[model samples]
Target chain A: MSAIERQFYHFAFDPASRVVRMALGEKKLDVTEIAVKYWAPTDELLKLNPSGLLPVLVENYEDGQTVVVCENRAILEHLEELPLSPRLWPVPMQERAEARRLVGWFERKFDYEVNALLLYEKMEKRLMGHGAPDINNLRAGRESLRDHLSYFESLLETRNWLAGRSMSYADFVCAAHLSVIDYFDEMNWQKYPHLKTWYMVIKSRPCFRPLLNDILPGVTAAAHYKELDF
Target chain B: MSAIERQFYHFAFDPASRVVRMALGEKKLDVTEIAVKYWAPTDELLKLNPSGLLPVLVENYEDGQTVVVCENRAILEHLEELPLSPRLWPVPMQERAEARRLVGWFERKFDYEVNALLLYEKMEKRLMGHGAPDINNLRAGRESLRDHLSYFESLLETRNWLAGRSMSYADFVCAAHLSVIDYFDEMNWQKYPHLKTWYMVIKSRPCFRPLLNDILPGVTAAAHYKELDF
Candidate 1:
């Protein structure tokens, strides 16, 4: 295991990349991080993952064998398979299903509904040299975000974590998406009290430390972005 | 295991639903099928999956225990966890990564690039009464599909399967997406002979039988859709 070296390629603001980074942080595994821009992906990044997606992990073994894992589900599952503590999936069949379901929910629904509108207008456009943000898209994305946040708040009203009592990857998954949104000051912290409290706790974790430290070029973080007590 | 029973809810034309159905078929798991229309989703369907996504599976145990799994990754992972033959993932680490990566590719890339354009204009608009197909969108989707097909054909030129030597779930994933596109006669089969041949071999499998028989209401399948020797 000592001979195995890891290299992770990702964009700092990419929600998908954040999930991998936070998961790796949770697993307490060290890796060499290679930052790439979403607008201008490097040739090496394309060679590794033809899809040109972020957060690709490479595991290099002593025998010259290399495994290039791409996509969130594949990379996360591959990491979970390692002999590591803190199992991501819960014990109960239903909870595990719930966690994965929520993970899919954010990836499928939230990404389309919120990120495509909100994050794209706020973050990606800035990074890509695209002109000023579209007010209509920003408004539409915010409207959709409220609905999604209310749904999560409903779940948090009963359960301690996103999935259930125990903390699962689903929480990290939710935080990764919301944190990037929150970075742009989109979240109305006063409305969702329960989610606000939950966010503060999860946001204060050691794994989340790296995320707060990350500085996105050309974009200024929100006033409370780096604060644990926010 | 005789004390256990299974039920599946799906929409016939849904690519995500077909992936689950095909995987279940390959596992030889008998499930009671419940057809639900996409436009008018039943209350029970929304209750099972809040997202109102198709292909939710429920397993009932003799002890009055029931497990509901929703979404493709969660449901498929749950099914693979069962003690079944014909593993979906290959043994080699790299092959396993490749298989999962391709699955994500179809879900994220193909769904956005092709299905949202081609399938939406062709099948969904008719089902939803959203008017006639848009020729511009169809042309754009076909152009994108050709690019994707060339990539697949390049892979098929070397490897026996989509992921690698073993006929893992990656083949089923690609088949599921392509099957839906082919249903609308969107696929230009002649351009990619290797992919066409690969599709022929997979399309002949017994697991693919139900897909062939499935008829989406108000939409006639392409003439060659059910032909095994096409």
Candidate 2:
């Protein structure tokens, strides 16, 4: 086998970054993790990812060639192409499409409606030295979260996983965002037992260990953040 | 061959919807276009797409089976799987990743920074009975559009197509947003010659015909919206 080197540029608290990290672990790729200050990115970081986005994966082969993959969606799909054991994507074509759709839902729709509000206000703004989070924004995010969590719970009531019968990237994407929300003590898990159970299954996986250990200075995680059971 | 029937529920000015339409056309799928009122979706539309988003594609086979695909990213990837004449995705694996990466860049980054601002203010707000557009949002969108257009120009200077040598979904995604911006007479195409040239190439394709013919009520297309040369 050719010598392989991998590195991930990420933010400790960003949901997208967490998703990529979990995907790397699931694929069994030994990668060096580097936290990027997206709000104040360095020149080298910008050169590596022109978009100046979080969760950029860099791979180096023995042939001295390097490839950088940006965007969480791109990174997950790229990882699936590798010869990894226990695939993150389902095998059936229709199931794959459904998984991709749910991934999109969490990445784009849920991110825009929920995470953008919650994270931007609760975490990123403070990190960037902006004023304290706006209460209205947090309220909006919490309202949207209730609806989204209910939707996920409904899906869980029927299927073994978010997409279908197998655990796929869809679960990771949801759990990643949920983890961030849990850090703020925002989720009311009692109302959604099925969704909570689904999350427990994901939390028990080895790939989720690194995410549970992440710590951002000046902001402590919730008491149960690292616990397998609440 | 089994009889195939397809329908697309879309909004006239949504960029994501436009991207799916172009993808379907490129794949030579005969689809009935239904302009959905996303702001005030009917029960039927809501039943078809629980998310109440625009650009939902429904496929019906001759045997009374049906499949509904949501999310433009999922729809584009799904269309690529069909046994169509021209391929929207590239052949090589790495190239395919690059294409998908570029597609992600436009759909998420560009949409958040540019299209969401411009289109929401210029079109959707008014259509939804909101008063006049906000000046600051429009200003922000224009500024971002300049940067995104330059980025596209930079990419075009080196490659024949956005992702690589041959046309792919990346080109269509870009053109989809550009066409919507063009409809509002917001683009300064003369400044970015390379980008303009690239747009012309994509614009001349047969798949772009239906988009050219799309006319939203009370909104007129630019003088060169449908022109082969401008």
Candidate 3:
């Protein structure tokens, strides 16, 4: 098999992109990272993806030929299909569907309630000259987090992993988003012991080492960000 | 093989559920329908699905055997795995990924903007006990729809189907969401000729026939809701 050249375009602060980056690292795929600032949308990136979203992968770029893949979940699935990469999805149809479902659950439901609120209310303002934070929305987001966390706790009580018995893309997709929330000192680890334990296991993995060091402008991770047993 | 008993709980107001219903019809699956009003948020249904969402398919009733599938995209994928159902996903890995991505795009991006605005603002007030419409959000959604429509137009211009040359789950997923918005007369068909033409063809299919006759409480579809040439 020939070596594949890949380029990943992502924003520094975006969690979805971060998840894709972590997956790439896990797969040991060499990729060039192009930074994108969401506040200032560029025409070139817009041409590549009209959705105006981050974490797009361009594969086997050779002057005129390139295949653009958008959506972080799709990118992860694409990488898993490659023979060189470590298997990130379970083999059984039931297990694979469950993993994919959890990925979607985090990306859609958790991201909307937690990541979007935190980014727009807390982070985006610092970067984009937006006005004061919407306290009501943020408060509601925080309140909603408790329920979601409890769900995670119950999920963790049954299995060592998020999706199933095996480690899969679902774990990365979730940890990627949660790490962003953790950076803001927003997650209440005490309330979710099982989740905390699961997170620590993920944090210790070599694949997640680089993620702990990611520094965003005007935003600092929690003091225990790098601590595996926080 | 013993006959598999399936029960589908859905609401007329839900476009996602409608897609599942259409797929069931096409596959000729013998399933019983239990109408559910999404706004009520019943504890019974909530027990079945912690998400409290509609379109939950319960398969194999004897001995309490059941599989609860949420997220319309995931549910459709699960249905494809059933023994007697017609396959909606492509055989090739790349093509399947493309189809799934389009399904996600329609469900998350397009539905979030278009259906959320049109249904929640214009229709939900009458069905549920929601407050008056937010005109600003509705207008913003309409403006966003123009951008999404243009993307769909470009997509339809290149391929006979939404995801590729063959009709797949992606087409049903998109058409399902669009049909909901079209019922409210939210889509400006003249602005996107290709998408409009493509929608007309999908709407005329036998599987889509029930959707044309669907009636939401206190809300009537637009005058041209059933018109194939519209």
Candidate 4:
């Protein structure tokens, strides 16, 4: 008998990679994490994924075969195919669609409307040696974030989870993006009580622990980031 | 027993919607197409998908149940769940990952690098009444397009399909994007022999006929756009 070894190439604070990390934890799949500076992706990373996008998952089966899955959409689908307990997608069709919709929301809509401005200005600029955050972009991004938070709060007011009763990939997608933003101390947690409560519960899950300790050099996470209850 | 009523809200030139159109065609599913302006979405469209993105699918089951799936990723996943004949995702794990990776490529990286500039300049600007296209942006976008085309050409030179042996969603995704670009007379088919051959074969499929006839007002397609062979 042989083991299925896995290696994950990802960057800390990358929302996409963060989702993958949480899924890996939930699935209890042991993998070696290889941290990479997303701005200056390595040759090996580019070889595995021509786009040099994070994160890329390379799974090595003992039979000398390797499978490389790149980015969030591909990686998540690949992971879901495994016969593991605690499904990331819900069992019911409608619920699964809801979960998938929210996941797409974070991937395309939220990332563009929020992270492209907020994360790029705050985190990516510094990492890419492009200097400090732009105040105008930061303001716009925060405004967008508030609008998004309110929307999420409304959903949470009605349902137990973002998608519905089940804790699915939608929750992780939200948590992943929000966690990265929270690290920059950009969120006004008090404004959305429902979202704040949801965050507290989501971040406390054992799968989220590793993410709390993830440190990007010279960048400090929010003061309350590590706390289980805040 | 009542029939399943499906309504697809989409814009003609939208690459994402085109993919969905082909999927519906391949599955031989009956659907009502309600064309909407992607730039200025209607109230009903916004109600179904708050993001106001193209290609929102509304399914009204015979049982009086309704399900709405928004955007490409969600819509594609929802469609795949049905007990349909043609499987979009390849059966083998590695091949499926390849198909998914290419789909994600078009969704994120390609959309940003090429469509954001090229389509926005050539097509979207005209639709939005944003005035003439910027020459500099067009140059940059064309350069990026050439690079991407070369990459795809190399892949096609070896594999029968974009994702290897099986004809999967990867082919649809590629054809969708390229068909849109080719409509604007941007693609130089003679340069990439393999890609041209592949495109001709793909576009000649029964499902692609409707897309070939799609016309945007005040914009002319390439001279050879609708031809089965070029």
Candidate 5:
């Protein structure tokens, strides 16, 4: 059988892709990164993902057929099953459920509020010429982000990681979304001290280097983007 | 050991809870259903779930402590692990990932477009004392629902069930949301023949009977709600 080819198709600046990229880096998987222009939705990418979303990992297993895994949470779950990575999910069923819940929370709630707001309001307008930025929507999003950050602050008060004591997929998912908003200087780090501390630990990890180096054409990282202590 | 005690706190009219209730029924687990007043936004429920979301399952898993499983998808995953129920998730990693993706798509995308729009425009105004319903948002939501229904029709074109050949958690999730909209006579069954057929099969299942019997005090089921053929 020919060697299996693993490829991930995503925009470099995408928050979802950053999470998957971090997971792949942690796994030390040699996968080719195919840059997708998310602004201009391509039929090929849409064919791979019916939702026309990003962070799709095409895994060429030994059987020659490629398995297309879309959705950041789904892709992370798929990667967790492989032996290459140190187990990112907890073994206990209850603990694993908690971890998965947080991952979904980040993807569905936080990403929808923060990343969608920042990207659509700030980035997409420049990238795609979609429309004038809606300040009201952005304000609502920022308020939602503060509410979410407060919730995370409370969670981090007791547990070391977002889900629990150990670093799991939840941390990466949260970090990925937050990093994108951080690029736009959207999050107020001081308001969420515990979240800030937890984020600092994850952000300082070796696997996070690729994400820190990510620079979009028009967007610049926050002043404290590379700082270990903000 | 005392019998495992499970309590599910949610509004009977909520689609997310309906899915969890069906899953619980399938497992033959007795859970005391506590109806949450969605309009009031009680502190007790919010304390249990900081997100203030419905369908929070508190499981007393034979151990002294109880596990709070939030998120409809996570609750379904927890139920799938219990020894009582037949497997809803496939054993293979790839199949499981596929099931998870479909569940996410339905709960997030389809629910946002179809259920949320229908509920907010038609039902929530009556419940929340919100201002006159926004016609434009409703129109956009209906258009999006048509696109979403077509996707489901296409899925049913090939497979017996939403996720695949077998009835999985995805079916319960979709059926739960659809049943809620069906309550309001929002779904035009004739428009998508394939989806209607699929819905009928799911609606007929014994686990779905409780949902059918559920009657919100002030709200009435659509004229065709009880008609199996409709």
Candidate 6:
């Protein structure tokens, strides 16, 4: 069979984009990655995904069929359906549901409470030249992050992975969100030891390596952002 | 085999809850519905779902095991997995991905741009006794809803259903969101003929019967809310 051509449209600091990126990496799929400026998305990007969301995957199969998938969860599920080895989803139905649940938790609730606030304030507005970050929003986001991180710490104390025993999409989704936040150097890993350790394990994964190298203009990641042993 | 007892915790006007409710009806599953006051979620609600979001589905299976599933997508998938008739998802993998993509689109994008704004300003604040509606937010939500409705109209013009041939979760999710907005008598259906017709078809379904009867306290639905020909 002839090789399929794949293209991934994404943004650097976007946690959702990172989720698709890590999932692709886990599947060992070689594809071209193009970064989009989310603030001023190009017409081409808008045409590709009318939603104007990041992490759009375009696949051209050998059978002359082309498919374009948007939305992070949709892309992740699509990749999981492929006959590739080292499946990112767990085996059992219940465990798989738990993995999807945690993925949804990080993608929706945590994002609404934390990531959206920080990214809009610290990242998007700056890119769009809106204004300086709002102190109130940043404060609220930071507070929520602490609470979520503490919960993650508790989860890690009992389980080897976030969803269960295996390193499923849940782990990748959480790590992707945390890594983006870590780019702002706001995470106080000292307070949450178990969560920190769990993050360290994910950070060391080969699939997560490319994300560490992502550098946005004029922004520096945390001191230990790229270090696995930190 | 003994019958499986199921309880669904939901809010009357929550779109996500409506999605699950409609899915349950389509599958012909009998489940007890419990209304949740989202503004002041009880401790038991928190324990069932720490995210404090609904609708939460608690299943008492024939095996005498109890399971609690939260998040609309998770609950819908769980119900779909059961050995029941009338599948909500399509059979082919590609079609299924498209179904999920549209479901995610309605849940995230539509929710963010339209439902979140309108509900928070008009519904949630009043329910929580927080304050009156914000004109700016309501205006923004109306504008976004128009744009989204136009898109839906275009989709319905080409396809038999939102996602594909047979009615799927996408139709239920979009219909659910629209039903919530329609509760306020805000939709201008005459402008988008195709979308209105599509909604009318869904409204006439036996699965959509329960949703039509939903009446929020002190909020009178539009005159045509429960009318099949509306």
Residues A24-104, candidate 5, lDDT per residue (tens digit)? 888888789889887675898888777777878887778766677877867876787676657898766657777877877
TM-score of 4: 0.97
TM-score of 3: 0.88
Residue A28 error for model 4, in Å?
0.4
Candidate 1 at A75: error in angstroms? 0.8
Top TM-score hit: 4
lDDT (tens digit, per residue) of candidate 6 on A138-204? 9999999989998888888998999888889999999999998888898888898888889988998
Kindly report which residue pairs in candidate 6 clash with one another: none
Against the reference, the lDDT scores of all candidates come to 0.90, 0.85, 0.78, 0.90, 0.79, 0.85
**Candidate 2 residues B1-230, lDDT tens each?**
33288888998778888888888777777889888877898787888767777778888877776777787887887777677769987875556767888888887689889877888899988789888999999999999999999899988899899988888888888999999999889989999999899999888888898888989888888998889798
Error of 5 at B21 (Å): 1.6
lDDT of 1 at A139: 92
Model 1 spans > 4 angstroms off: A1-3, B1-3
User: Mind sharing the TM-score for model 5?
Assistant: 0.90
Lowest-sum lDDT 10-residue window in model 4 chain A: A1-10
Candidate 5, what DockQ?
A: 0.41
Model 1, A50-143: lDDT tens per residue?
A: 9998889999988899999997889988887787878888888878889999999988899999999999999888887798999999999999
> Considering every candidate listed, which one attains the maximal DockQ?
1
lDDT of 1 by residue, B1-230 (tens): 43289999998779989998999999999999998886788999999999998789988988787888997888888877778877898888899999999999998899999999999999889888999999999999989999999999999999999999999888998999999999888888988999999999999999999999988777788999999988
TM-score of chain B of 3: 0.92
TM-score of each: 0.96, 0.93, 0.88, 0.97, 0.90, 0.94
**DockQ by candidate, in order:** 0.84, 0.52, 0.34, 0.74, 0.41, 0.52
Better candidate by DockQ, 3 or 4: 4
Model 3 is docked with a DockQ of 0.34
Q: What is the RMSD, in Å, between candidate 3 and the native fold over all Cα?
A: 3.1
Could you give the candidate ranking by TM-score, starting with the highest?
4, 1, 6, 2, 5, 3
- Per-residue lDDT tens digits of candidate 5, residues B71-168? 68678766765666568876655566667778778765787776677678877887787877788878887788778788889999998888777888
